[model samples]
Target chain A: GAGVSQSPRYKVAKRGQDVALRCDPISGHVSLFWYQQALGQGPEFLTYFQNEAQLDKSGLPSDRFFAERPEGSVSTLKIQRTQQEDSAVYLCASSLVATYNEQFFGPGTRLTVL
Target chain B: AQSVTQPDIHITVSEGASLELRCNYSYGATPYLFWYVQSPGQGLQLLLKYFSGDTLVQGIKGFEAEFKRSQSSFNLRKPSVHWSDAAEYFCAVIEYGNKLVFGAGTILRVKS
Candidate 1:
C-alpha cells in the first residue's frame, strides 16, 4: 500500500481564488493529519481526523481554511479566498493506532498564492 | 505545550565523516520524539523515533537517535555521512492525540 498521497504536487493560485488540496492516506489507517510548512520552516499542525471525525483544527490560521474527510479515507483541505501568506507546502500523514506511532508522510503539495 | 528546537540552521560535513544533528525539546511529561528527513523532491521519511524504554533508537538509512530525558533532547546521529544524506532534517514531538510539532529544521550539506 502507498504511504500517503497528495495530488497536484504543485499549485499556483491567484489571490481571493478558492482552492482545494486532496490527501489520500494509507488504506485502513485510522488517523489522518494535515500540516503546513513555510519555506525554510518546519511543518505545523493544521488539522487531525480519526475515522472521518475531525478532532482538532485549532492550528488553522483563519476562517478561510477548512478540511473534511468523509468516510475516513480521503481528505480535502479547501481554502476560500486565498492569501499570499497562505503559500506553503501542505503535507499529509497517516498512522495506524494513532498514539504517537510512526506517521507516514506524503510528498506534499506546494501551494503558491499570488 | 510541547516544542522542538533544532539549534543549527545549516551544517556542513565531509563525506565519510561522522555527523550529528542537535535537537532539544520541551515538554512537561515524558516526550515522544522523532526525526524525519526530506530529500529534494521527495516525501518526508521517518529516520527514527523514541517513546520509552530504549534510550538509543536505530532507524533506516544507517541513522540513529538518542533520547536523553534529563537533557530534554533527542539528537540524531550517523557514524558515517553519505552524499545522499544531504537533506533537511526535522525534529518533532507529538502533542494532544496525534498532531506533530516540528522544529524549524536543519539543512545538512555533505561535501564530497
Candidate 2:
C-alpha cells in the first residue's frame, strides 16, 4: 500500500513569492493533517481536515498559510507572500479515522525561502 | 494548553547497550500518547502508542514504552540498541480533538 506522499520534495522560493505544497494521502483516509517542522524542532500542527471539510486551522502561524482538501483526498498547503521565517519542512499525515488512529506520514516538502 | 516535553536533547549510547528516553506530557484529561522516530531525510515513523492499556506497550524494531499516569510520563526503552536505531525521537499527545502536540524531540547517537 502506498503511504502518504508529498510532492516537490524540495522547494526554493524568494521572499514574497507564493508557494504551494501538495500531499496525497492514502486511499480512503478520512483524516488529513499538515505540520511545520523548523530546524532542530519537532513538528508543529498547522491545519487539519476531516474529509472535505476544514476542521481546524488554529495552528497556522499566520493568515498567509492556507490549506485545502476538497474531494477528501489530496490536500494542499499554500503559503502566500513567503517569508524567511517560513523556511521549514512541511509534513503531511493521514489516518483512517479522526480519533485514536495512528497517522501515516509523508516524507515532507522542504521549503527554503531565500 | 496541552504540551509535551522531551527532557533530553541528545543521548549517546554504545551499540547493544540499554537505552531509555524520557518523555513527559501535560494535559488535563486522559491522554493518548505516541512515540515517533524520524531519520535524516525520512518521514516520521510510529514507534508505539499508549491508549489506555496495561501501561506497557511494545512497538516495532525492539522498542517498548511504559506509561506512568502518576508521574505523567511515557518513557521509551530498548534493551539493546542497534546503530540503525540512531534517530530523533518525538513524544506526542493528541489533544483538542485530533491534533498532535509534539515535544522538542531527543536525538539518539549510537556508537558502535
Candidate 3:
C-alpha cells in the first residue's frame, strides 16, 4: 500500500464488549507502532513492533489492551471489556528500516464506547 | 522518562500573520524532537525534526522550528498564516528504541 492502512475507521462498542482494530503497515517497514489519542489530546504510545518480535509493550495501559503483529506487516489491537474511558482514536504508524526515520501514520480508527 | 509540553491549548491567528507555537521537553540527554500536524479526519504528518546539526530546521507548509537546548524548548513558527493551516499541532520527543512521547496538542485556529 502507499501508506499505513487501518480498518474500521469508526467503531462503536457497548461497554464490556470486545473490539479489534487492524493495521497494515507499509511494505517491508521494520518498525510499527500503535497509539491512543483521546479527544483534544495528542497520541500516546501504546506498543511497538520490530518485525514479528514485540519488543515494547510498556505503554499498554492495562491488561485489557493487547496487540500483536504476527507476520510483521499486519497488526491487531484488541481491547477486552471496553469501558467508557476506552473511547478514543486508535492510531497505527510505520517507519522505514531505521528506527529514527519519520513515521507514516494511518487515518486512525475512532472507537466510541457506549 | 521523556515528556513534551505544549503550553498553548489553543491559538488563534489572523491570515498572513506570523505565528508561533510553544513546546518544551524534558529528557536526560540530547533529544530527538519532532513537530507534527494533524488535520481533521487525517493522520499526523511530520512537519520537521531535530536530530542534530543546526538548531533551526525548516519543515513542510512553510513551517519551521528552533531547538534551544538551554531552555529545553522546540518551538514551531511560520512567517505567515493561512486558513488552510488551521489544525492541531503536536510536539514529541523520541526515546530509546524509537518510542515517541507526545505532548498535549495545540489547536491552531486561522482566521481569514
Candidate 4:
C-alpha cells in the first residue's frame, strides 16, 4: 500500500511570494494533519481535517496561512505573502480514523523563503 | 496549554545496550500518548501509542512505551538498540481537538 506523499520535496520562494504545499493522504484515511518544523526543533501542529471538513485551524500562525481538503483525499497548505519566518519543513500526516489513531506520514516539503 | 517534554535532548549508547528516553506531558484529562521516530530528511514514523487498558504498550522496531498516569509520563524504551536505531524520537500527546502536541525530541546516537 502507498503511504502519504507530498509534492515539491523542496521549494524556494522569495520574500513576499506565495507558496502552496500539497499532501496526498493514504487511501481511506479520514483524518489529515499538517505540521511545521523549524530547524533543530520539533514539529508544531498547524491544522487538521476530517474528510472534507477543516475542523481545526487554530494552529495556523496568521491570516496568511490557509488549508483545504476539498475532496477529503488530498489537502493543501497555502501561505500567502510568505515571510522568512515561514521557512520550514511542512509535514503531512494521516490516520484511519478522525483522530487518536496511528498516523502515517509523508515525505515533507521543505520550504525556504529567502 | 498542553505540552510534552522530552528531558534528554540527546543520548549516546553502545550498540546492543538498553535505552530509555524520558517523556513528560501536561494535559487536563486522560491523554492519548504517542512515540514517533524520524530519520534525517524524512517524516515521522509511529513507534507506538497508548490509548487505554494497558500501561505498557509494545510498538514496532523493538520499541515500547510505558504510560504512568500518576507521573504524567510516557517514556519510550528499547531493551537492545541497534546502530540503525539512531534517530530523533518524539513524544506527543493528543489535544482535545485531536491534534498532537509534540515534545522537543531526543536524538539517539548509537555507538558500535
| DockQ winner | 1
Q: What tens-digit string does per-residue lDDT give for candidate 2 at B18-112?
A: 99999999988889999999999999999999888689999999999999999999999999999999999999999876889999999999999
Q: What share of the true interface contacts does each candidate keep?
A: 0.90, 0.78, 0.70, 0.80
Docking verdict class for candidate 2: high
Clashes of each: 0, 0, 0, 0
Preferred candidate (TM-score higher): 1 or 3:
1
Q: What's the CA error at residue A8 for candidate 3, in Å?
A: 0.6
Write down the worst ten-residue block by lDDT for model 1 chain A.
A94-103
Which one wins by lDDT: 2 or 3? 2
Q: For candidate 1, lDDT tens digit of each residue in B1-112?
A: 8889999999999999999999999998888889999987777899988888879999999999999888998899999999999999999999974899999999999999
**Model 1 misplaced regions, further than 4 Å:** none
Best by lDDT: 2
- Sort by DockQ, best first: what order? 1, 2, 4, 3
- Taking the tens digit of each residue's C-alpha lDDT, what string does model 1 give over A13-83? 99999999999999999999999999889999999998899999999999999999998899999999999
**DockQ, model 2, C-alpha based:** 0.84
Which stretches of candidate 4 lie above 4 Å from their native place? none
Q: Residue A14 deviation, candidate 1, in Å?
A: 0.6
lDDT by residue for model 2 (A1-114), tens = 999999999999999999999999999999999999999999999999999999999999999999999899999999999999999999999999987788999999999999
Q: Can you write out model 4's per-residue Cα lDDT over A7-108, one digit (the tens) per residue? A: 989999999999999999999999999999998888999999999999889899999999999998999999999999999999999999976777888989
lDDT at residue B38 of model 1 (Cα atoms):
92
Looking at model 2, the pairs that clash are: none
Off by over 4 Å in 2: none
Write model 4 residue lDDT over B4-33, tens digit each, in one string: 999999999999999999999998788999
Candidate 3 off by > 4 Å: none
